[model samples]
Target chain A: MSRQQRHDARVPIALAVLGWLAVAFFVLPIMALVLRVPWSSLSDVITDDATTEALTLSVFTSVITTVLAIVLGVPLAWLLARSNIPGRQFIRALCTLSMVLPPVVAGVALLASLGRRGVVGEILDDWFGVRLPFTMPAVVIAQLFVAMPFLVLTVESGFARSAGTVEEAARTLGASPWYVFTRVTLPATQPAIVAGAVLTWARALGEFGATITFAGNFPGTTRTLPIATYLALESDIDDALLISMVMVVISVVILVALRGRWVGAIGGMR
Target chain B: MGWRNWGYEVSLSIDVKRRIGATQLNVQFTVAIGETVAIVGPNGAGKTSLLRVVAGLISADEGRISWDGMVWDDASSGEFSPPEQRPLAYVFQDYALIEHLTVGDNVAFGLRARGVRRRRARERAQEVLDVVGGSDLVERMPSSLSGGEAQTVAIARALATEPTVMLFDEPFAALDASARAHARRLFSSMRSLSMARLIVTHDAVEALTLADRIVVVESGSVVQIGTPSEVLATPRSHFVAEILGLNPLSGQLRGDELSLGAMSLTVGAHGVDDGEVIAIVRPRSVSLHRERPEGSPRNVWRTTVEAVDRSDGRVRVQLGAPLPIAVEVTPAGFDALATELDGDVWASVKASEIVVQPA
Candidate 1:
């Protein structure tokens, strides 16, 4: 064999070893859970009424939360990435603070600000007869608070990578600011938006502490799969395992579909 | 449709100040109907900055940009039109083709932005693409295009807009030699048909070939403005001479002696003086004779061949020793001088052809 050929052959094998190590690290716990799960009780656990309700609520709230995040987060990402407004850096930092905060801490902060006895909550209850805590809205708000940052961060980075010259060209071509943004800038940044949306939806699906604390984990309203899994873990291991497996399967399916797209989107930008 | 003969009349005076940057583009120039103006300068000489100011991409702190008797930007009067409102199109150096869009779509982008209907915009875009020889690649994305193809698409897209004025920022810089040659030919053909073009390029060949008048800018100022022949015959600044590839040799010409720094060479012509004089000499004018003839036309120097470079169809030989002279010769001259090493060679130049300018 040629000297150069022997050097080139080792690269793929070395990369393959690292890839296997990452896979093993992420999959070992899931593998253990599936192996220990009683196949006989799996059908019974799936048939549980509370489990079905929790699964339905999980999907519903996660979808709603992701939608809300998109509506607010896309504009915020655009502003953070493109604008030279005052205190923009501070606002961007504040948006991503939720990503670093513990879910319980985030729930506490939300409760203090919007609970019935809390500052705005007292006024909302007295003036408008509105109670935000222990509601489905609270679950969505909690999920959005944590997951929206993922979307904003991902999309903002995409915006940062995109050439501003294209936008300038559009403007020179007689496009108004709004037209340039909507037709040119938005389409260019679509892949970033999609990847960010997927990440946010995944994060929303896995939310637990904030939702359980602020929304009170009601079966038909806010008791999502992660909450139900935790509650089931207290009393029944088989049900918890099954619920966990279901969450994993759903997340894995969505992730597998989206991973290729995310890679493709980023690669296209380069 | 053919462009209207709207003779360019813009009285522009710009003064801008920012935190870490400032640009002062204060100059007034006019172009005749269908005239092509070339802004020649190095990067960051405020050439692009001036174009931006005129196009209304950036408003000057204190300036008035009145094009064709219409005020695009008048800071004192608080009149500033956005880039979109201005009837101008710019071809960026990078081509700036929308990567996600097809060539046809990109060309159509400008028309659509101007509120043109979809069908009409596409038809116009197709017409332009045909002119630029890019009709076959209309459906192709920007990623698939070669450099020349992409540049043609960019120009086609710009031309499709049919604006009153077209600004190009080194449009041929990214293209290869053949592509640049083709682009020059394309511009020459479109000169009579298109609107007034303002091309910003450092290439002398591009300027001389495509521009009707050249505006030489350096250090945030317009150094010289003239036709290609005028600028070539007489360059105002060292920058202009360097850019045009003319060797601006400074020397004192007194009586029959020309003092070039420490060295003094005797010339045939005697009427010249001391203090601040530039000698403009073309490389092709200097001859490398085998020996110094008894009677010859003008200045002579015995020098060695420093370096040799082949360009276009000619060979340029760099002379060594007391004075470094770049001399261009044909293939035959090169072949004759090929065997000659780094030894002595007699160099002679005509006295009349050597243009002298004030320092």
Candidate 2:
């Protein structure tokens, strides 16, 4: 053996053994779930009224939440990435801080700001006779509050890495400011945007803590798939696993279809 | 040479001041319609900065740019026209074609920006592409094009705009020698067009070959402006002299004698009393000999060969010590001399061949 190889081989083997043990420790739980799948009664478990309603509600709310994130979040991403406004770093940090917060804290924070007796909610109720808490829209609001940060941060990094010179060349060719943004800037960063939308949709679908704390668990009103999974755990554990399995399947399909290249491109941005 | 016999009227006047770090650019010049002006200058002498200011890539500190009674920039009132609104076409050094677009779409970009229909824009773009000899490249992507093909598409895109004025900043700089010849032919065709042209280049050949007039700049200022012949026969500054392939020597003038440091030379004169004068002589004007020639040439010096560099099928022999000079000799003449490194030689030059300019 070469001298350097022999020198490196002098190190103990315990750490390598411990590293593989750690990998097995992390992979073992997913293996256990797949092993005990309860496959025969899966369809019967999922077709029940509460299960179907929660499943459909998740697909509905998450899709709507993702659409809202794109409509509202892309402009904010562009502003954060391109504008020379002062204290932009601080503003960006504030956005990141909210994403890292516990979901229960986000739910409580949303309730304090928009609940019936809350600060803005009281004025809103007095003036417009409108209420937001414990409603279906409240679930969407909670999910959006927790999920939009993923979209905003991802799209912002894409815009940051885009070539600003192409935009200048476009303007010199007589393209207006808005046309350049839509034609040059937006298309150049489409991969990040697609990856971000998928991430946001997935996060909204799996949102449980904020939705439960703020929107509550009424039967057909606010119970989403994750909420249904939580309620089913107390009575029927098999039904809960069936709904969880559906969630896992749908997430895998969406990720596999969108995951080939977008994730790899944004890998450098991270 | 003195702005005499000019047939065209001035259409563009740029009188602007800008500061980039320690260098301050303060230039004032004009371009005539139906005439092409080439800017030749040393690197970092504000040649590209002058074009960028005119193109509105950067704003100037003071002054204004006026073209045919239209005000482009007036700094005192903070009035400025952005690059998009100007009716000038700029072909950048790298072409800057958008990578995601097809060649036809890239050329059609300007037309589409003005609300032209997509089908009609591509048709118009195709017509111009044919003029530049790149009609077959319309269906190709910009990333797949060679340097010369991209340059042709860039010029085609600019031509589609039908601009009133045009600016090209070293358009041939990115191409190979063979490609440059093709680009040169395409550029010479632009002479028939009525648009005002200002081309910035460091190569004297491009200026003399393509430009109707040349403007020489130094240290962010316009040092001289003249036709190609005038610039060659009499360069006003040493920088322009060196750029035109001439060796320049400056000294004090006293009656018929030009005193350069410890050396003096007799000159035939229609003369001034006494002042600083610069005499420039091309390499072809100096002739080399093994011993002092038996002719009546006024300037002759015995020297040793320092270096011999060959280019363009000719040898440039560098003579050493006491006014070291370069002499361009033909291949047959070089064979006759059989010049070698560190060899002794005598150089001779006629007094009438020197160009003297007041400093």
Best by TM-score: 2
Compose the digit string of candidate 2's lDDT tens values, residues A145-170: 89988888889888988866677777
Which portions of model 2 miss their true places by more than 4 Å? A1-19, A260-270, B1-10, B234-239, B246-359
lDDT of 1 at B322: 74
In the predicted model 1, the residue pairs found to clash are none
Task: Specify the highest-lDDT model's number.
Answer: 2
Model 2: residue B133 alpha-carbon error in angstroms:
0.9
Give the CAPRI class of candidate 2.
Answer: acceptable
Question: Alpha-carbon error at B324 in model 1, in Å?
Answer: 18
Model 1, docking class: medium
Error of 2 at B182 (Å): 1.5
True contacts kept of 1: 0.90
